[model samples]
Target: MSKVRGTNTLPEMRVRRALHSMDYRFRLHRPDLPGKPDIVLQKHRVCIFVHGCFWHSHPGCVRATTPESNGEFWAKKLAGNVERDRRSALELAEMGWRVCVIWECETRYTDALVLAVNRCMKHSGPISL
Candidate 1:
């Protein structure tokens, strides 16, 4: 567990790079907000969360499996992660912030990831990015 990383992960970097290439500007992890979203486009009131499949318990994701040993502990820990994520997303929504979660598995495909990001931004509003 010592090697587990919470921020600046490869998946997060991939998303950041895609945003930059698309000429979108953003801030990294604003502590003042709930969950400290991985990327924030303050001007557009958008927050991006780059969630690991296992950590955030991505539904139907193969990588989100748990070990047989200490299964109880793993289940509880993963459940807690999901709960916290849900709360944070809700809070951000209440604050009128648009939240986007880019899963780690999705980052594996660069082209698709870019399109996904673009689509997400489009839904946010009339932004000239």
Candidate 2:
């Protein structure tokens, strides 16, 4: 568990590089923000979270499978992660920030991920649900 990373992960780096190449400047994990979003575009008021499929319990994701041993513990831990994510996103939305979650599975397709980020940045106002 100690080896696991919470920030500057591969997926996060990929997204950051892609966005930077596109001339989109962003802040990294601003402490004042709810959940301290991984990528914060102050100009666009958009916050992006590059989440691991397993840790965040991505719905229907193959990597989200729980371990056979210590299933109860893993289940609780993952559930808490999901719940915390939901709460943080909601709080950010309430604060008029656009929240975007880029799942680890989606990072495999760089083109699609870049397109999604572009769309999110272009979007104006608070996200609808």
Candidate 3:
């Protein structure tokens, strides 16, 4: 829909805020990047994508439920999103950039989101739940 936004979304903002609070600096949606990642830490060579569960079709996510109306269209659209995501991530990885995909559901827990950012930054130590 026209109301749908592709950037600065609530989930993306949540991740950005958490990372900023952790003293991490990042760039927002660099067009040069494969996917114009939500957060790009050039120093750390990491790219973060804050994907909506419904939009990106997050596996096993309740929010990913398909719409009853226009079933075929929604399925096709969602599937394309997933495919493009995978291709973009692969391309970024091949280009030597560490890619991190944080689903909308994961953004609900700031602590976990922070941990995921840290992990993507390659900080040492176990990633406990």
lDDT of each: 0.87, 0.87, 0.87
Off by over 4 Å in 1: 123-129
RMSD of 3: 2.3
lDDT (Cα, tens digit) per residue for candidate 3, span 1-129: 999999999999988888787678999999998888999999888999999999999899899999999999999999999999999999999999999888888888867776776777787874433
Deviation of model 2 at 127, angstroms: 21
TM-score of each: 0.92, 0.90, 0.91
Q: What's the lDDT for candidate 2?
A: 0.87
Clashing pairs for predicted structure model 1, backbone only: none
Report the Cα lDDT for residue 30, model 3: 97
How big is the positional error of residue 38 in model 3, measured in Å on the Cα after superposition? Answer: 0.7
Instruction: At residue 2, give the lDDT of candidate 2.
Output: 97
How badly does each model clash, as a count of residue pairs? 0, 0, 0
**Where in model 3 is the C-alpha error above 4 Å?**
125-129
Per-residue C-alpha lDDT of model 1 across residues 71-117, encoded as one tens digit per residue: 99999999999999999999999999998888899889876686668
After superposition of all CA atoms, the RMSD between model 1 and the true structure is 3.0
